[model samples]
Target chain A: MTSSTPASAWSRDDTGITVTVSGAWITSRLDQVGWPKAERSDIAGQVVVVDFQKIETLDSNGALVLHRWIEQLRKSAATVELRHPPAFYERITDAYAQSRTGATSPPTGRWGDSLAEIGHRAIDLAKATLHLLSFQGQIAVKLAQTLVRPRQLRAKSVVHHMQAAGVSALPIVGLLSFLLGVVTAYQGADQLARFGAQIFTVNVVGIGVLREMGALITAIVVAGRSASAFAAQIGTMKINEEIDAMRVIGLDPITVLVIPRVLALCLMFPFMVIFADALGILGGAIMATLALDISFGQFLRQFQTGVPILHFWVGLSKAPLFAMAIAAIGCQQGLMVGQDAASVGIRTTAAVVQAIFFVIVIDAGMSIFVSILGV
Target chain B: MPFIEQNFAEPKPEMMPAVRVRGLRTQFGAQVIHDNLDLTINRGEVFGLVGGSGTGKSVLVRTIIGLLRPAAGQIEVFGQNTQANSAAAQALRRQWGIMFQDGALFSSLTVSENIDVPLKEHTRLRAADRRAIIALKLQLAGLDPSAGAKYPAELSGGMRKRAGLARALALDPKIVFLDEPTAGLDPIGAAHFDQLVLDLQAALGLTVVMITHDLDSLYTACNRIGVILKKQLIAGTIAEISARPDPWINDYFNGPRGRAAAFAGAA
Candidate 1:
């Protein structure tokens, strides 16, 4: 990497300051020779002569550095002159210099820009909410119309989405529900042991898993997986103009794309909740038997007698609302994707966040409604 | 001193072409696109490459730029072997630029930021200098100065192509490879683009390898033309190659649209 290039240096002579630049001044070697910085005192009221006579090579980057350094010296009120430079230095730098005449530089970020961005985001959020509400109304109308003409439902696509959103989701849903059940039972048994009533842990596990944990955990997992998938798939299709193609061919994209996914999630969600309940109760029974000194038979008996059937229905009842919200948010974000690769990623993240947020909010509302009815 | 100085800006008067390909083979799996293809693009000339769809026009460009490895044979740019791992070969890379079809600009960056990308990476110039050069490049590509602030998605189709050209010219590359430079522009827009390429080539003394389907671009801009057929390249000047008895070449050059473009070029 070593070369016999002279280091660029400056010295004061009787005439003025002569800065000699030597070596290959191309981009690959510019850092080695380095640019000369002028102090105001050194060149105050003196003409600075930059001698480029000994420069071995020059490229665009080298010329730019020289041009900029000279501009800086002239700005400091020192006269700078170049001596015996290669013909290409002026040729390259002059082209860029000419472009500075009419060009507006990029805007720097300001406090006003930040405030405007916040205002824009607030408006975007309001618009998105309105869009989602309108989309939901459209879905409701389409669903009602499809119910009247069942053959228009695209049964094959619905079945495909069911298998995709439900059948493949079994292992994850089952495993997470079982773990939730175990944690609930173990924690309950420990707390109950302090009151000398460890056997009542069965009631805690049964009531908790059957009423809330089963539905909430399954919905969260599905929202994370299926919702993001739906957003990304539809977003890519929208970017490729496949959605436009379908519309031009007289096929309603809402009927063809949205209904099947929403219907699949709505129909399959209850079955997923029921499967989660059984596994969750099974996990609770195992934990009770091992930790609370209750036999599996005793745990089941307590779970059946202590937890009412209404509590199981209370959890199962929330599944359709959660599923619809998740699916709707996912589809809405997909439809909203702008024309870029970055927006697909942005919308997929928004789909998961909105779906999970709405799920929790809806669950809280449902809990209040059920409590008001004394269910 | 001249021999040892190694000045890239002033390429010495030499017989070497800007790009040289010898016995190059390219393939995807069992499907061979170019087999033992040889090409030579002279320095300081506008070279147009035309071929039927699925021919290896883009593939050859990719191989020459070291994006795709050649299955066999060699590629050289400015007399340096492209496949070499030497420091000199690495330095040789900065000498050329490529513009893909459809103006593949970075979706996140503004057009000026896009042009600034290579300069920022390869040079230590101050920020103001880089911005000045970005404005220069945008002007050279025949774009308005205000266009530098807009993202690629916001630009019109012709503007996007010009932006892509501006980015390619950012580093003042000696050789530029342009893939389908006028594929989607209107007729007038495409003609304006052809003139822009010719003007830039003349002003910068660039060796331009353009892959195009526009007969107007071929007639108006190119100093020579290369046609890919049956996995081989047939290359010569417009008059020389059009005189060949090849059926596709004859159909391509003497076709109605081709004749109209040729008449326009003559006018």
Candidate 2:
């Protein structure tokens, strides 16, 4: 085969055929002969082999044609051999295969499709905002109903929700927290002991636990667990038309459903934080006893000395704020739940993600404020 | 031909009507039911409304009691225009009661608690007085007094309906609208229910505007019958409706079921 517009290729067979791969004016020399790829080794046999002896340099398209030809030979029962294509041919072939599998797919114009989608999305968003605005009056009425009917958001109900979310979850929280403290203490003691500071592991563990990390961890766990609870409960109620029933009967669904939950969570979080802190400290004491050979009494003495009373207060302060934000975000998404029950699961998931995200953001801010205060 | 030469039970029009609906028009969407419909409900009267489904008999009574607002009409309760947004309109509403098809019983509250709701809302009665009144209404509705402590969920369909009725009468409403009050009941159950309605109407002097598909209810309980068809009312007794050759009227009163009613009356 030679590089020609009306191209050709030659086979060793007596009744041979010459095939050309041509596109526009420009064509490569290898186009005159179809490239060889994979084929069967013997006539009327299916054992595969590749023959590239008749073909030239393996540019990607040439290699592709060669592959096709070889595949055809392999499908039929025919013996084949390849002199192994030129280096350029192998390189182009490898590049093409890598691209086909890799992050870069042959451009099917997804980038253009994506841009068009974004434009359509922008228009849809604008329409939705306008639609939601018309419901502003309804929102105000709902809010008023929620606030005025304290019976709906009764203090009794808050206690019930808190008991389920906070009290019932106590066992898992306790187990996880005790292990976390033990791990922290063991790791921290080893590092501190290198500098003759094994006793300061009390300070290290105490400072970390009573400060942001302990509270942050607890909040994240509860945010994932409790916040989603609020969203799912309320979202399910909304879908069932139970919320509408409340409204028709002159009751405030939000106060009855949401306020109690938020209040309960706010009341519950600080206690959970305190419990977690205690468990974590106890865990550290166990680690300290085993690793540093420190007696429990001595560990207590070190802890008392290192972790000031003020640190406990600082840690305790973050719990209520964290709980409030988590519960608020959860209830908000729940109230925003759509008619479909599937949206209940979706909103609950969103609530958890959003609550944890805000917890981290707020934790960062808390750290800065605490540093400035020098507690 | 006069359809009512033989109305066994006739309305004495000399007495004051408890409700007077004039030119009532209730429109939802493009359709108008109660289009220029007029009806007068007399004191101590069980007024039966018979209609093909969706002819707006429900809408007519709903508009009169202000449960639904009529598009254009004068609903005068005790001679006061109910559409007027004055204290009188609400006062007129307070004078009458309505029982919806769904029971509309507050599901969250217990039966006793549900009965107490309207009393608590409107009356200055003390808790003890409210309890006594609620108990009386329960007994009057033929509900078991023991069932009072149970929530709506625990109660059967028949019990919920009775409990709902107890609540409707809690405020001592002078007029009561019962829409298909005996629906979904056996023959004997429906008969006892009809008797209960007649008793309540007599006892309370209530002018009952009852919308029912039950031909038996129309024959037995109603002092005056109004047929709603083609968005207009053909007002008279059952026999009056029977003789009217208006195809829809004939279909209602001279058709197979109508003939059976006439046969039963003769027997």
**What's the DockQ for every one of the candidates?**
0.42, 0.01
The best candidate in terms of TM-score: 1
Residues A225-273 of candidate 1: C-alpha lDDT, one tens digit per residue: 9999999999999988899999999999999999999999999999999
Q: Model 1: per-residue lDDT, tens digit, B1-267?
A: 779688667444355789989999999999999998999999999999999888988988999999999899988888889999999888877789888887899987889889989988987666876876777788779898889889888999889989999999887788999999999999889989999998888667789999999999999899999999999999998889889999998999999988898898889
Which one is best on lDDT? 1
- Per-residue CA lDDT of model 2 for A1-375, tens digit only, reads 132332233333442222332321111222234233323342345333343443432323334445444546656554444444456445434443443332322236655898899999999889755643443344446546656875545767877988987898777777778888998898998898799888888888888888856687789888888889888888888867799999999876755776677678878888899998888888889888888888899999987887898888888899978987787778777887875555777889988998898898888898799999876
Report per-candidate TM-score of chain A alone.
0.88, 0.62
Clashing pairs in 1: none
Q: What are the runs in model 1 whose C-alpha is more than 4 Å off?
A: A1-25, A30-33, A37-61, A73-94, A105-121, A290-292, B1-15
State which docking tier applies to candidate 2. incorrect
